[model samples]
Target chain A: MNFIDFIQAITEYDFLQKALVTSVMVGIICGVIGCFIILRGMSLMGDAISHAVLPGVAISYLLGINFFIGAVATGLLTALGIGFVSQNSRIKNDTAIGILFTSAFALGIILISFLRSSSDLYHILFGNVLAVRPSDMWMTLVIGIIVLGAIYLFYKELLVTSFDPTMAAAYGLSTRLVHYLLMTMLTLVTVASLQTVGIILVVAMLITPAATAYLLTNRLSRMIFLSAGFGTLSSIIGLYFSFTYNLSSGASIVLVATALFALVFIFSPRHGLLRKWKSPKKELTT
Target chain B: MYAVEVEGLSVSYFETTALEQLSARFTMGQLVGIIGPNGAGKSTFIKAIMGLIPSEATTITLLGLSAKEARTRVAYVPQRSTIDWDFPIRVLDAVLIGCYPKLGLFKRPRKQHRQLAMSCLERVGMQDYANRQIGELSGGQQQRVFLARALAQEAELLLLDEPFVGVDAGSERVIIDLLRTLRDEGKTIVVVHHDLSKAADYFDTLLLLNRRMIAVGSPADVLHAKTIEGAYGNPLAFLQKVEVSS
Candidate 1:
């Protein structure tokens, strides 16, 4: 379809509208939290939490409750488990993350095998943005507000804690509490993103846009805003590609985001590889 | 009242003792230096007193208040290496972190707080660099930013860990002068120092430590050959000879 045809389809179809709104909301929230995730060097942790929520999703399907509630509960448990194991043992944090996420993902696979409605399971693994219901859109909206509001309210605490936990603690802020709060926020963002990109691709949403912005900006606030803008732009563009080419929505979305990141990686004026290669004389002059 | 006091404080890592049972007190308005050989628990000692690390102590107080209660009134500058200098924050924003404890949760830094942070940067001679990204600054400038953050805390007591390691000479001189000024303003300053040569001139009181309190007194009294030998072992016999000669 041409651009005019796509715009007509968006207005004519309710499912497309819902998908677009849901994808954009997911992008904005993920971009905002992804800044903290990348800055704290917790990109892998974001991946781990996203994957570890699978068992909770399957279990919630069995119990006839909202998958989001189950996913968040299990996400928090996974975070606490990783924290506990890493803190108590000689094994490092990355090792602990590796062990816990794999075990949880395996458990999810086992549970999913027993479910009668396996079609929903497939959608959970590879997102079906076109299948997003109006209720799911509302859930995503509410969660997006909560995550954004929490970040706004505790910006300074999170900043100090992430930047220098030693100083944060010395100033009487509870570093452990701040850490767990961040974990909880990550869980919320992951669960909210489940329908947009599914578990497998959610981590891309959490890291790519933020990292792209990181390469372009020198300030965290600006990085967050730029990441959100990139995320929203990628989602809108990805939706167009999916609609026109009859492609999988989540994959297209992630691919566009990744492509944007690659573009920025090669061409960002301040930190780009190309710029650095071309500006050898600038360094000498400075 | 003493600026800091501790009784029978001890810290241990897994399968290794970091600091043995130790007792010491530091009076207000004094510039104290904690000097020890590598792995002598100099950093560990300050961390424990600040409650950054878990430890057992019979009694610990700051200005007659419990350590936990007085923590907000204290400022600490960790080693430069411990911070992620590449973080995407301007120097001004970093300095404003010192006011976080006061603002607590839910409140943003107001105009007054910004002015206070800028003033602290001015005091550190970094006001011109406030808008610059932290990673763009030199090592000494980064140290000055940390100092500016500590000053913005407006604390009565300051604890610094290895403030001079890998720093340029100009930064070193600036830091020492700043500490002396803070001291004259009646704030207690404790520095974890390694350079024995400068220790005599830098600190009014010397705390010679080696997993335990070896000595604590005025520089003239504690810089003795016997105390130096006790804290640093025979590897520094040259220091003892130098002390006797001087």
Candidate 2:
């Protein structure tokens, strides 16, 4: 199918429209939340939480309930568990994340094996946005609103806490509370994106666009806007290519984001590789 | 009135005691310097007072209110190294964080807050660099931006931990001058300083600590040879050199 054909299909098919809207929403919230993740050096946590949601998804499938509730439950449990282990023991945060996520992922695999008749496992693992149901679409939309709304309402708290938690504490802000809040939001975003990008590729969606935006801008607000724009564009373009060439939707979207990241990596004016080579002297003069 | 009052304050980390039975009071409108040898719990003292760390204190008050209640009336300037200078934020926006306590939750900065932040930046002579990224500034300039942020907090009591370390002499001069100015404005200012040579010139009162409070008095009284030797563990050769130069 060509670009024209893709557009025509989107207008004709409800499933295509749902896929487009859901993927785009996932793209946006992931970008926004990913900014905080990267800024706080919690990219690994994002990956861990995304993977840990699998057990929840599996359990939700087994219970014949909405996967959103199950995924979120497991995701949040993993996040809190990671925080607990790291905070209480000598083991570091990354180590805790490594231990918990793998265990949860393994349990998820075991649970899914028991539900052999649910052939959508491959779709869940690799994403099949073309098969997104209306419920999933609405879930993504609701998650998008909550995530964005929370961010907008608490931008100041988030900014201060991320940049300097010590200062935030001095001013009577609970850094730990803000951290947990971000973690809850991360779990929500992860669950919402499962239908569009799948469990395996959701982390790439979370980190890449924000990191690309990081290389381009010097301000958090600008970085967030730029990241959301990049994520949304990647989703749209990736969907177009996926529909046109029979490619995996999640892989195509992740590849597009990676390509955008590479472009910014080489050509970003401030921290770019190409700029470093082009004008070392210009930097000294400036 | 006392700006800060602490009684029976003790802080320990695991097995080691950082501060032992410390009781002290800082009066209002004084520029006080906490001078201590290494491992004297200078930073720990500040952190404890700000409630940044766990400690045991029989009573701790700021501006006649409990530490928790008076947090809104207090401003803190943490060590420069504690902050991630590479954070993607502009100078002006960073200063705006000082206004967050007043804004409470769910409200963004308004026009007046921006004006206040800009004026605070101007006070620190960083108005020209308002739009500059934080990572782009020099150590002193960055420190000044932090100071501007504390100023924007509009607090009655200011607590600073080592605002002068790794700073250029010019920046040091600006900071000391600004602290003096703030002191003159009837705000109580406390600084954790490393350089003993500048302590006499910088602070109205000097606190000498070595895991315990050695002395707290006017610089003339606290700079005594015996007191200095007691806190610093056998007056080093530099003490003589400094004494000779003076």
Candidate 3:
């Protein structure tokens, strides 16, 4: 179908409308939280939490409860496990992340093998955005609002702790509490994006758009807005491509986001490779 | 009342003793420089007192209050290397973080907070660079930004870790002058310094540390040969250097 037909198709089908709304909501929330994750050098931690939610999803399926509660529980468990292992022993943080996420992911695969509804597992691994229900869309919207609201409420605390925890503590703010709060927000955002991006591709939604905005902006607030803009735009474009070519929705979205990152990486005014190449003397001065 | 009082502050990392049974006291309005050799626990001492590191102290009080309660009235400028300068933030936003604790959890900074941050920036001569990206600054300028943030805290006690390291002469002079002004205004300042020769001239009091309190007194009394030898064994070389410089 052509562009006009695609637009018409979206309006005609409720499933398409739900898919479009869910993707945009997922993009905006992921983009917002991803800025903090990348700034705090927790990109690997984000990857670990996203992958680690698999076991929770499987358990939630077996127990017949909401997947979000299970996923959030497992995500928090992974975060705490990584923290405990790294903090209590000689093991570094990245090493702890690697150990926990791999094991958790492996356990999830094993758990899924024992389940009767294994076909449902396939959709969870690789998202089927077109099959998203209206209820799922509402859930995503509610979770998105909660995550964004928490970030807004704790913006200063998060900023101070991430920048300099020492100063944060000296100022009477609990740095540890802020750390856990951030991890909790990350968990919520990860769970919210699971249906739209799947387990494996959610980290891209969290990192790529924010990283792209990081290249273009000098302020965190600006980076957040720009990141959300890029995320929403990517979701729209990727959803269009998916509808037109029958592509995997999650992969298409990630690819579009990555392409945007590449464009900014080479063309951003102050930090871009192309800008440096154009003015070597100015680069040296900076 | 003394600005700081500690009976026995001990800290250990893994199996290594960082600071052992350190005891010291300082009066208010003193610019105290903590000078010690490498691995001598200068940073550890500051971090321990600030409760940044795990430590066991019998009695550690600041401004006659418990350490935890007194922290609200304290400002800390950590070492330059502890921060990620490439993280996307403006100079003004970074300084505005000082008001976060005052604003508590939900309340955002108002116009008055921004004006205070701007005034702090002006004190450090960083007002011109307030709109610039933090990563775009030089090392000295970045240090100044950190100092500006501490100034914005408006605390009664200030702890600075290696504020002069890698700083340009102009920035160094500006920082020293600002610190002295703060001291003159009845704010207690403690600086972690490395240069022994300049320590005598920079601080009104000297804290010679080597995993313990070697000496705590006027610069003239603490910079003597015996105390230098005690803190840093066989201190003939350092003593002669200090003697010649003085």
Candidate 4:
């Protein structure tokens, strides 16, 4: 549907208004943090940590606390547990993260089953963006601002560390410090976006835009800006379609990101699938 | 004080001892060469000096200060084969990474950092291809990009591992000339090299290693026939048959 119809629909209902505003703010935060996740080679970890946040939220609900605070606490706990356990001079990072995230997710499932609010377990399992409160919208906005400020302040070092950890080491930037700080920031973003997009789609929120943008550019500065734009556009379009058709907002947002990924993957100039094939053009030139 | 000093250093990879109880020291402003057979500690010593290797050796200190402090003065270029070539990065941008330390965390590089990076690229005669992707460049050009990064660091001490191993002779000459100029400008340079033939002409000091310090001195003192035989082993037997038959 067109913008006019979408705005008309949003005005007609409180739920639509809440979903549209919340998803957009959450999208920008995930876009910025997801850039870091993609560059740092931690897309898998991003998925694991976001999934792990569910149990924390469920427990928070049980204890009558803010669900977002619970998710943030659990996310930080998971990220730290992964970082700390992997540093055990023996266990690799993947195993620790794998074990931690799975157990936490299992606990989250159990808690959700027992609590079973009127909305049903799957409501939180797959996010219900339309049910977001005004506080969630404000929290997402604050997260977006913080993520932007952090990226802007540490632009040079983050870029270098992502590309060359060894060189960054010689320059006196501690890899371990950057690694943990980034994980913490990632946790913050993951938890903040959970209400709008749900656990299952958060990875796509943080990774697809950045990974797709990577195909279209090599410069770091351009990569950040383009990925943010792609993410915001995905949220807006996805929100509109969900508003018109009454589809699941979480799945719709992810579908939008996946669509962008498909477009970039097939047609991107540098490393796209279509360009990678047909070396016949090279044969002709050579 | 010496620029670098290592005493009874040892490093192992899995079950293999790459460097075994090697000891050495070098004064300031010397152009040094580290030469050995394929399995010897030539590259290992460089890694050890750069603290890239996880080892229980004595210690590596650059200048008189601790290794971390001396880092601003010391830079390293790993073997050309060590990098992932397919990583999407531009030559100019890659070289500019050297300035990251000075800029620190959460800070954008100002005008001075850019000008420094450009000057380093100019010194290596790579000013024209600054915008090219690193993977698009030839082996020599890749090495030049690495060299430009080290130069951009403005390091007083440089440890380079196999800078010219697989590149063309022209690129090798360019590297040699650039290194010599760097040394002339009062920087200490050490390289891990495999070609024993040019050991005498290329460096002011020679260090021959085979899991240990086999020899260390001026090339005139260390490049004797016996030392070369000890380092090369009996590999010349196959080459001798080809020489005779041809």
List CA RMSD, all candidates: 2.4, 2.2, 1.8, 3.4
Q: lDDT at A192 for candidate 1? A: 76
Predicted candidate 3 versus true structure: per-residue lDDT over A56-165, tens digit per residue: 98899889999888898998899999999999999999999999999999998898888846667777777889999888899999999998999899888888888888
Query: Each prediction's DockQ?
Result: 0.59, 0.61, 0.65, 0.42
Better of 2 and 4 by TM-score: 2
Candidate fnat values, all? 0.80, 0.80, 0.76, 0.37
- The sequence of per-residue lDDT tens digits that candidate 3 reaches over residues B1-246 is 778888899999999999999999889999999998889999998888877778999988888888788877888999988888788889998999887767787999999999999999999999999999887887789999999888888889999999998888888999999999999999999999988888878999999999988999999999877888998786674666678856
Segments of candidate 1 deviating more than 4 angstroms: A280-286, B235-246
Clashing pairs in 2: none
For candidate 3, the iRMS in Å is 2.5
Over A1-286, each residue of candidate 1 has an lDDT whose tens digit, in order, gives 7878988999999999999999999999999999999999999999999888899988998999988888888888998999999999999999999999889988988898797467877778778888899999999999999999999988888888889988888878888898888888888887877778888898999999999999998999999999999899888888899888988888999999999999999999989989888975333110
Tens-digit lDDT string for candidate 4 (B29-110): 9999999888887877876776766766666667876676787888888788767565557888888888776666556667
* Per-chain TM-score of candidate 1, chain B: 0.95
Best by lDDT: 2
Error of 4 at B127 (Å): 1.1
Once superposed on the true structure, which residue ranges of model 2 sit more than 4 Å away at CA?
A116-118, A281-286, B237-246
Score residue A274 of candidate 2 by CA lDDT: 90
Residue pair clashes in candidate 4 = A153-B106, A154-B106
Candidate 1, after superposition: displacement of residue B2 in Å?
Answer: 0.8
Worst 10 residues of 2 chain B by lDDT: B236-245
Clashing pairs in 1: none
Q: In model 4, which runs have C-alpha deviations exceeding 4 angstroms?
A: A1-3, A11-14, A83-92, A116-120, A278-286, B12-18, B39-41, B52-54, B57-59, B86-88, B224-246
Q: Which of candidates 1 and 3 reaches a greater lDDT?
A: 1
Q: Which has the higher TM-score value, candidate number 1 or candidate number 2?
A: 1
Candidate 1 docking band? medium
